[model samples]
Target: MTRITMREAISQAMWEEMERDPDVFILGEEVGVWGGSYAVTKGFYDHFGEKRVRDTPISESTIVGAAIGSALTGLRPIAEIMTINFAFSAMDHIVNQAAKLHYMFGGQLILPLVIRTVGGGGRQLGATHSQTPDAIFAHFPGLKVVAPGTPEDAKGLLKSAIRSNDPIFFIEHATLYQTRAEVPDGDYITPIGKSKVHREGRDVTIVTYSKMLETSSKAAEQLSGMGIEAEIIDLRTLRPLDMEPVLESFRKTNRAVIVEEGWRSYGVGAEVTARIYEEAFDYVDAPIQRVAQKEVPLPYNRTLEQLALPQVEDVVQAVKEVL
Candidate 1:
């Protein structure tokens, strides 16, 4: 095992996948010459050449459409959209085409495409580039949504998404790119539709993904010091969610708190809370609590933005309320 940053792990995954499968290629703006906006694809253009690591115009819709077209014809394409907020421009292709192609064709076509993008706010990127769209894609029937928190999960989940037969919307946290963790040397893949218990406890269950997972973990640590043990469950894959671990945790703890960086209304946490209530309501000893961002346009001020988003303290308070 070796320690590496999330950004390096992601790049390594792409490089290894490209080396192993000739069908796997990357396409997006600044992906080649610029080495990707976050430098995740740094040096990839030279390594893979322009044929495989091709760069395109600044058009999200066209990029997604081309990826879908190539995927239908047997080429596994990884489409980088730069940011989740920009993906709104290409919703038609991502929602209607890339997602529904297989089911629409009655399983005739295998859309093995991975849509990679950075999401969440921590760098003060303003409102335009900082929205978390995991819930949006999760709501759709045919899309596989993944939000990995740690460097290991980022690498393993990306590899799995690239190999899967369905289209995967792989959401990465912008702030976690530089976070380092130990990763396995050999090729390995973390299965989709699986949840991992990040930190186990018996007092309360905190369900979250992506950046919120880090927040929840920190909150759990703080809660531990206060005699309130909280278990953290990382929902690696949002779509086709593996609820077994969540239900199991809820059964043991009988209290729950869902943490998400997105807005509260209709967010991924809402879905999780609803699912828990429906499946394990009788087992729950208290009402499920949801910790999420404020329902207002993200402010430009750094302090205001931080206030608007869910913090570690917010998660702790929510857990206490539920307990």
Candidate 2:
């Protein structure tokens, strides 16, 4: 086992996958010469050459369209959208074409395509660039949504998404690229659509993912000082969201606090809270609470931006309210 940053883990996953499968290639803005906007594809251009690590114009639609075309021709394409906010420009192609192609063709086609993008409200990227619209994409069928919190999951999940014969939208937190964690030093892949328990506790179930996972973990530690043991469940995948672990945890604690970097209304927390009540209502000891970004466009000012985004204290308070 070795400790590495999230960026390195993601880079290693793509590197290994491209090396393992010749069909796997990457295309996006600044992926080649700029080494990716977030530097996740650093050194890929030189290593894979222009034929494989082809860079395209600053057009999200063109990038996604090209990837879909190549995937239809039996090539595994990893399309990078630079940022999640820009994904809206290619929404038609992503949701209509890439997602429904295989089914529309009666399984005669396989879109082994992965759309990689970064998102989150930090680093002062302003309102337009820093948005976590993961739930919106997950709402559509035939599109797998994955957002990892740790380096290990990031590496493994990316590998699995590349191999799956389905369209996948992989979201990476912009602020978590520098976060470090211990990862397995091997050619292994983590299955998509599985939620894993990051910390075990019997007090209250704290469910979260992506950048919010880190925030929630910190809040859990703070809650410990007050004699509160919070069990953290990372919903690594959003679309095929696994509720077994979440339900099981809620069954034990009889309480839950769903945290997300996005807004609270109709967000991930809302969906999880609904599912828990629907399946595990009998185990409810208290009303579930939600922690999420404020209902406003993220500001450019650092102070205002942090104010709008969910914080550790917000999570702690939400947990207490639920408990």
For every candidate in turn, the CA RMSD to the true structure comes to 0.8, 0.8
TM-score, every prediction: 0.99, 0.99
Candidate 2 local Cα displacement, residue 264, angstroms: 1.2
Candidate lDDT (C-alpha), each? 0.92, 0.94
Give the Cα error of residue 309 in candidate 1, in Å.
0.8
Q: Pick the candidate with the highest lDDT.
A: 2
Which stretches in model 1 have alpha-carbon errors above 4 Å?
Answer: none
Candidate 2's residue-wise lDDT over 160-215, tens digit each? 99999999999999889999999998899999999999999999999999999999
Model 1 vs truth, CA RMSD: 0.8
lDDT of candidate 1 over 1-323, digit per residue (tens): 99999999999999999999999999998999899999999999999999898899989999999999999899999999999999999999999998898998899988889999989886787878778767988989899999999999999999999998889999999999988989999899999889999998999999999999889989988999999889899999999899999999999999999999999899988999999989998997998999999988787789999999999999999998997
Off by over 4 Å in 2: none
Worst 10-residue stretch by lDDT in candidate 1?
Answer: 121-130
The TM-score of predicted model 2 comes to 0.99
- For model 2, which pairs clash? none
